[model samples]
Structures are given as C-alpha cells and as structure tokens.
Target: MAGFPAPQTPRGFGSGKTGMRTRTTRFGRTVVALMLREMASRYGRSPGGYVWAVMEPLGMILLLSIGFSLVMRSPALGNSFLLFYATGFLPFNLYQRLANTVGTSLPFSRNLLTYPAVSWFDAISARFVLNTMTQLLVSYVLMVGILVVIDSPVVLSFGPILFAFACAALLGLGVGLVNAVLFGLVPVWQPIYRILNRPLFLASGIILIYESMPPLAQDILWWNPLLHITGRAHEGFFAMYTPQYVVNAYPIGWGLVLTALGLLLLRRHHARILQNS
Candidate 1:
C-alpha cells in the first residue's frame, strides 16, 4: 500500500479489475529494479564474474574430454568428445543453474521482499531473467568455441537447438517456481529436495546416450522431462545423430503443467508466504 498507488474505484463489485492492474504494474517495476540490482551485485561486483559461466562448462568439457579420451576411443555422437559433452552439458547446466537460483530467489532476496514494491513473483522473475540470459550467453560462447576448434564441417541448426534449450529452461522455471515456494515456506523441504534431486544431473543425458540405454531404463527415465530436452539438444548439435526416443511433447507438457500449477498456488498463498518469510 505504501509503495503502490492508492487505486480509486467506484464503490462497486468491480474493484478486482483495478486492484489486479495496480499489482501487475507494480510487480513489473519491482521485477525490473530487482533484476538491475542483481546484475550489478551478482556480475558487476567482480571483473571475472560473468566469465565464470563460460569457464565452468569449459573446464568440465576439457576434463571430460581429456579423461574419457584415454578410456573410450570415440564419443557416442561425434568424433570430438568436447563437442559431444558440450552439447549435452550446456543445456543441462543451464537448467540446473536456473532452477537452483530461481527456486531460492525469494529467500536470497528476502530483504527486498520486505519492501512493499517487491513481491515473491518479482523476486523469482528477476532471478529467472538474469540467470537465463547469462546461461544462454555462456552456451553460445562454448558452442562457438567448440565449433571453431573442431576440424570438421559444422552444420548448425538453430531451430531444434533453440527449442530444446527453451524446453529445458521452461521446465527449470516451472520446477523452480514450485520448489521456491516449498522451500521458502517450509525450510525443511530444502534439504529433502536436494537429496531427492542429487542424481538429476547424472540422469539428464550427460554421461549416457538415451537411445543406447536398455528398454526398462528408458521407460523409467521417460518420466523425466529433462531427458527429452537433453537428447533433443544433442540431435540439434550433431547433424547426423538422430535420437529416436526423444519426444518434444514430453518436456513441453510437463513444463506447462508445473508452471501453471505453481503460479496458481503462489497467487493464492502469496500473502501467507510473505508473512511466513
């Protein structure tokens, strides 16, 4: 009420319209401010901050390539193990980074949420945009670096890669939305959620090829939407690799459902959550 404008409406049952519009406008402004603050504090504080994103995956790809090259002769998809793992890990890393940060955005920005202008939605949205853009930029750098280094014909298809990255991010956002509220309200769910999701990276198609897995394994992992997105990313990166088991609808469907449900729940319980926080 303090930061928000006092909306003057007729003494009638149509107050909902004005109230909703007021909150929406305020939320938009609050999210923008939060984003800028995060950008400055999170990235601008240090000279090497932004480069960490690129450095993280670059180190992983190099280590994997060097270590695995000795044991395994060739990669499952491409000749360059660096390219193969980069395609798989970059998207998964994006999802992981986004989900973890977005899920905890409220608590991390709890001080800001105390202000009337900043709401839970604004905090989460700010983190989502900042992290997503950073991850996308990091992915582009790593992908381009790999292509340039590889001594082979590069066939780039933007559509599928974009779709796969989009799905991965969507699913991350949806899951983060649900987890954010859960952890923010309960606190105990934080440890439990981490324990449950400890094996997520391993299962996200980074270490193993999806199509090469056994039938039962595929059936079990089919429920994981990330598996589909990760596989599709590889398909996009390597021109010749066609993974038959990757279903586009799987991740999209789950992402939509999770996101919608999380938003509905959050909208209904936002005030209670703020009070608890």
Candidate 2:
C-alpha cells in the first residue's frame, strides 16, 4: 500500500479548468480541420488557386488607376492613384468577400455539420478565419507593391488603418451571421441581398472621397458603416487628409448590434434551420 501509485483522473471529464481546456481544444481542432478542408475545396481544386485571388483585386485597382489617371492629373488624397484606390478597395473587398463566405458557411458545410464533432460555429469560424487571412495577405502584398513601384513619399499611420480593418472584418462577420440565418430560412433573401450590395462600392467612398461629395450625399452616406471604414483607411494612408465626420462608434455599433442579433437568432433557431436545410 505504501508503494502503490495514486489513481489518475480522467482527461476530459475533470471539473473546472480541465473541462474548459478540453472543450476549447476540441473546438480549435474542429475549426482547423474545417479550415483545411475549405482551403482544399476552394483553392486546391482550382487551376490558378490563390493566384486568382490577388489577380482579381489587382486588376480592379489597375483599371481604376488607369481610368482615373486619364481623367484627372492626380487622385483625391494622394498623387499615386494606386495607393488611394488600394486603401479604399482592399478593406471593402475584405469585408465583401468575408461576408459572402460567412453567409454561406452553414449551407456549404451542411453535410459535415451533421457529425457530432462539427458545429455551426465551427463552420462559420473556419470560413471567417481562412478568408480573413487570405484577404489580409493579398492586401499587404498589393499595398507593398504599389508603394515600392510608385516610390511615393507616403507616411502611414497604423492606428486608424488597423481600426479600419477591424471594423471591416467585424462588420462583415456581423452582417454575415445575420445573412446566414436569413439565407438559410427565407431562401429569397440571397438575391435581394446581392442586389442591395451592388451599390456599396460606389457609395462607400472607394471611387470618390467623402469630403468631395455634396453635403446631401455626405449626409446620406454618413449612415453607411463602410464609408466610415474607408474614411479611417484614408486617414491612415494620407497623412494630410483627416475626415471630421468619421465616427468610431457608428460602425462599431452596427457591428455589435448585428452580431448580437444574429447570434441570438442562431441560438434560438439553428436546429430547425439545419433540419429544414
């Protein structure tokens, strides 16, 4: 009896911190597996894969730079049209693509969701993390390329830029969660959402600066969270230009409110929605 070893406790069934760690580990593994699967299906099967991701955005930036160069001597904020448009377009694109991916996360992973190990949160998280990383990488590359190629004397303020990116990502996630429920249940909301989303680029200060817009336009667009995001981005990239109308609380509020509503709805109706699907 003196030499007998102490009995060992079970791994995952333990109380308090052990159980919490076990749950967190399981969720992390599930999310990672889903992310791997998504990368394989979405990019590995395609011909060009991730290359297309960079090309598409780069092409848009180039076209915008070329078109605007012909019309005007310089861009609104900076002499380099590429930098101005990249700052606006990249963050907006990140939000747009993230929202689309997260919106379809449940439907896309429907079969997998049936398994006990997988969950709706895991599915959404996989899409959100993978896509967000991809977009951020693309943005970094394109922005660096523009800065190097143009060799412009630009000073970047990371505070507003990081804030802008955070707002965009959270806003995308928030809207996507709500859309996920609506798209899964209503079925007709998908097309309607797309129709409504088309004008965001034009209205979001991507092609046009906010201060240049007429007062009426500014007043109307002030409510758009994307506009605030873009304004923050411009403030980061263009040191001289600061937008007085950009309110940090407005976009943050939209993100938090929409996310809360979406999570609440999902918690309440996810089972029925999944079953119906």
Best by TM-score: 2
Kindly report which residue pairs in candidate 2 clash with one another. Answer: none
Clashing residue pairs in candidate 1 are none
CA lDDT of each candidate? 0.84, 0.92
**Model 1 C-alpha lDDT per residue in residues 90-150, reported as the tens digit of each score:** 8888888887898878668878877777777788899999889989998998888888899
- Model 1 lDDT, full chain set: 0.84
Error of 1 at 126 (Å): 0.7
Ten contiguous residues minimizing lDDT sum, candidate 1 = 268-277
* Candidate 2, run of 10 with poorest lDDT: 10-19
How well is each residue in 1-277 modelled by candidate 2, as lDDT tens digits? 9799899887655686877988999999999999989989988977599999899999999999999999999899888899999999999999999889988888899999999999898998999999999999999999999999999688999999999999999999999999989988898999999999999999999999999999999989999999999999999999999989899999999999988988888878777778767
The clash tally of candidate 2 reads 0
TM-score of 2: 0.93
